[model samples]
Target: MGVSDTNYQIVYRGHHLEYFHPGGWVFFQRPKEAGGGFWLGRTYDFVFMIELPRPVSLREGILYLQQLKYESAS
Candidate 1:
């Protein structure tokens, strides 16, 4: 899990959905073994009650969170 002034991020080392940030956004990140990558849109018409993913690794998840902040800032 990660927290910053702009947003919060949680990385699941395992496969399971146990948390979410209401009114926020949800994204899916494919594992590296399965072509790992992720892209998050700037805005959404609706809120996502669940944000879950089985990232390739914890590093990938941290990278995703970093991008999340950068992308959303723009």
Candidate 2:
């Protein structure tokens, strides 16, 4: 699937975290200080959801969410 740049930009970023809300889905990433690296994940209902591999960086999370946005469109 092809994703438009304007459509998938992250909606928010702060405190070492990033957020993207594309349609009903909510995607976010946060640092895992204890174990190191970061946590990247997404949800539709905000309760049940999916996660990218752990031990990732904040940049990786953003890309993952962007990809999710594109894939979800399909």
For model 2, how big is the CA root-mean-square deviation? 6.7
Model 2: lDDT of residue 37: 53
Q: Across residues 1-74, which tens digit of lDDT does each residue of candidate 1 receive?
A: 43344444433334532455554433344456776554232223444433333333445545666886789999
Model 2 bad stretches (over 4 Å): 1-35, 42-50
TM-score of 2: 0.40
Candidate 1: which pairs clash?
none
Q: What does candidate 2's lDDT look like per residue over 1-74, in tens digits?
A: 21245433322234422443534333333334455554444433345244654546656766766787789999
Q: Clashing residue pairs, candidate 2?
A: none
